[model samples]
Every structure is written in C-alpha cells, then in structure tokens.
Target: MKVQVKSFFSVLSGGKPVVRTLDLQEGTTAEDAMKLMKVDFSDGAIILINGRPSNEKSVLSEGDFFVVMPPVSAA
Candidate 1:
C-alpha cells in the first residue's frame, strides 16, 4: 500500500516540512510509519488521517494521507 505521510514540526521552519510516499505493508499503523520515516514525535504529536483526528494504532489504507503535527512552542 502507498500512503502519504507529512509532518509539521513548526511553522517557523519556513515550510520545510517533509512529505513522503511510503510503500508500507497493508496493515501498517500510523505510529509504525512515523518510526520508519524517522520522525521525532517522541514528545507527542497531533496525528490525523486524511485531515481527521486519528490515533497511533489507526490502520492505514492505500492512498491515505497521514499528517503529524507536533505542538508548536516558542524556541
């Protein structure tokens, strides 16, 4: 299955966020995908599937869009 994964670390990053197309297993979960993508969401992140709220365990589908938005803070 092919899924699109995107992460927004901070708006101040000047739109350098990463968007990747992952060719994952059929039953791959959102969390697993993040790990495979090497995203540092250890502190926590707002996860969404196709623009809707989702959890780590959510099973992904073909052509699904997964987004990871971490809490923004003043650096």
Candidate 2:
C-alpha cells in the first residue's frame, strides 16, 4: 500500500510543508507511518486523513492522504 504524507510547519522540513510518499504494508496505522517518517508527536500536531480529522491510531489505506500540521496559534 502507498500513502501520501504531508507535513506542514513541521520539524521534518524545517517548518515547511513537505510531501512524501510512503510504501507501507497493509494494515499500517497513521502512527506507524509517522514513526517511519520519524515524526515527533510530542510537538502536538493535528493529524488529518484525507482532510478529515483523525488520530494516530487511525488505520491507513492505499492512496490515503495523511497530513500532519502544527496547531494554529492566534499569534
């Protein structure tokens, strides 16, 4: 299965949005994919799957768009 991952305002790309493709096995969870990419969940990023709000435990499917973005601040 292939999953498209996008990280916005993330450490992975020096706070820039970076899109990448991950070739994973069937039954890969969103958290698992993040781990593969070395995402730091401790930074408190919002997880979105195909633009829908999701969590780390969310299961991933083929052609799924897994997005990680830092929480927006008023400042």
RMSD of each: 2.5, 2.2
Best-performing candidate as measured by lDDT: 1
Give a tens-digit lDDT track for model 2, residues 1-75: 989999774654656777899999998998898888777877567999999999988999999999987766786
lDDT score at residue 40, model 2, on the 0-100 scale: 80
**What is candidate 1's CA lDDT for residue 60?**
96
Candidate 1 residue pairs in backbone clash: none
| CA lDDT, every model vs. true structure | 0.86, 0.85
TM-score of each: 0.82, 0.82
C-alpha RMSD between model 2 and the true structure: 2.2
Runs in model 1 lying further than 4 Å from the true structure: 10-15, 73-75
For residue 10, model 2's alpha carbon misses the true position, in angstroms, by: 3.1
The TM-score, computed over Cα atoms with residue i paired to residue i, of candidate 1 is 0.82
lDDT per residue (tens digit) for residues 1-75 in model 1: 999998776443676778899999999999999898776766778899999999888999999999988866799
In candidate 1 the C-alpha lDDT for residue 43 amounts to: 79
